[model samples]
Target: MSRLRPGLARVEFYAVWNEVSELLNQGHTYRSAYEFLSEKKKITMKYDSFRRHVKAQFAKKKFMEIDSQEKSVIPADNKPKRVVPATATVQAFDSKNAVPLSDLLTEE
Candidate 1:
């Protein structure tokens, strides 16, 4: 019952869906599949329309579940674990007590 473009018949609709389903099943990203359909296959459909079709006929839940798992793995605190080496630590008093770099610059 859906209205398609002039050249897109019912059989073509099934064919396009078959291609979309195959690409998605093989773990292709939505953007990659969309680009393949548009650029290589010449499907010429808009983004939202393609997305709707993907959501309806494909494993959208799998993508969502994987995204949620990734989010949960990152800890709330973003602090680094290891302490910086004492040799690398800088002190103002050490610099003040040290011979001036200007003296070295003048001699050089």
Candidate 2:
């Protein structure tokens, strides 16, 4: 059986998460900010939990913008075909009619 009084869960921190993120994004290290808040009785979660939550929030905001050249009709998970000019010719391998390397090179 648990011998603890009623308290808020970690999810409760989301209520003011944006504010916390803003504060941290303003050149404040997690350790210093967390320690200050912890000492001031403003934060209840442990340092590890605080850091994890902060990192998760930050990771969510990161993303890459795909250019028109890289974009395709295919699904985002699937790699798109390489883009080339219309004048470009696609070549195929011909093992039976291979060119000899000696014929292409001659001492001038």
Candidate 3:
């Protein structure tokens, strides 16, 4: 189940994602976001579909936080142990002594 309409191209998907992200970052609930989108005549998907789409895309895209710049946005327990700089090259995986590396590899 996903809130996003199927058969949408990348551009269409990004359009909806941008709007939804804005709404969510502004402290709107999923229900409220749906209503807002419906009011704007952007999406007609149901609540369940919306929830699924949000979950599906949660990791694929950057999320906006609903907090002021002066405030600490994320909870301490949720923070990443280390932040990777944008310019740094990220290693896909450590192949130090992995067995059957072929089975462990999967392209994003």
Candidate 4:
């Protein structure tokens, strides 16, 4: 039977995880961040797990930031604006005959 704890509480690792994520965003490689956390901070976890957590945290942060920006930029007026179509010629040419080079090049 494996001795590893199946349900490790994330609350215990939150601070260390945030630190690791910040280091990663500052251009630290996973290996470097792992070493720093393991040796200096005395935080221990599987390298793969740490890496995945850091990536997920960063992705979540980025997504939240983007969502906030989108929300702020959107106008308060919720009414839908009417869309006006452009006035353009809709021409249908006979497909049976090969189109002439000059006809094809001219703007309608």
Clashes of 1: 0
Instruction: Assess candidate 4 and give its lDDT.
Output: 0.73
**1-108: candidate 4 lDDT, tens digit per residue:** 223365352433576776776787899999898888878845566677677767777799899999999999998996689999898988777768767788878944
The TM-score values for the models, in the order shown, are 0.40, 0.46, 0.43, 0.57
The whole-model lDDT of each prediction reads: 0.71, 0.66, 0.68, 0.73
Flag the better candidate by TM-score, 2 or 4: 4
Where in model 4 is the C-alpha error above 4 Å?
A: 1-4, 7-9, 79-108
Per residue, candidate 2 scores C-alpha lDDT tens digits across 1-108 of: 222233342563575577577668797788877876667767677677778877776676552234443465557878668997688676898878987777678632
**Model 3 ranges off by over 4 Å:** 1-13, 62-108
Once model 1 is optimally superposed onto the true structure by TM-score, how far is the C-alpha of residue 5 displaced, in angstroms?
A: 5.0
Best by lDDT: 4
Cα lDDT of model 3 overall?
0.68
- Summing lDDT over every window of 10 consecutive residues in candidate 1, give the lowest-scoring window: 6-15
lDDT of each residue in 1-108, candidate 3, tens digit only: 354546443334356988888889999998898788867877666667667777668754433333343257556688558976689676686668656745668532
Candidate 3 clashing pairs, residues 3+ apart or interchain:
2-49, 3-49, 3-50
Instruction: Give lDDT: candidate 3, residue 31.
Output: 86
Q: Rank the candidates by lDDT, best first.
A: 4, 1, 3, 2
Q: What is the lDDT of candidate 2?
A: 0.66
lDDT of model 2, residue 9:
25
The pairs that clash in candidate 1 are none
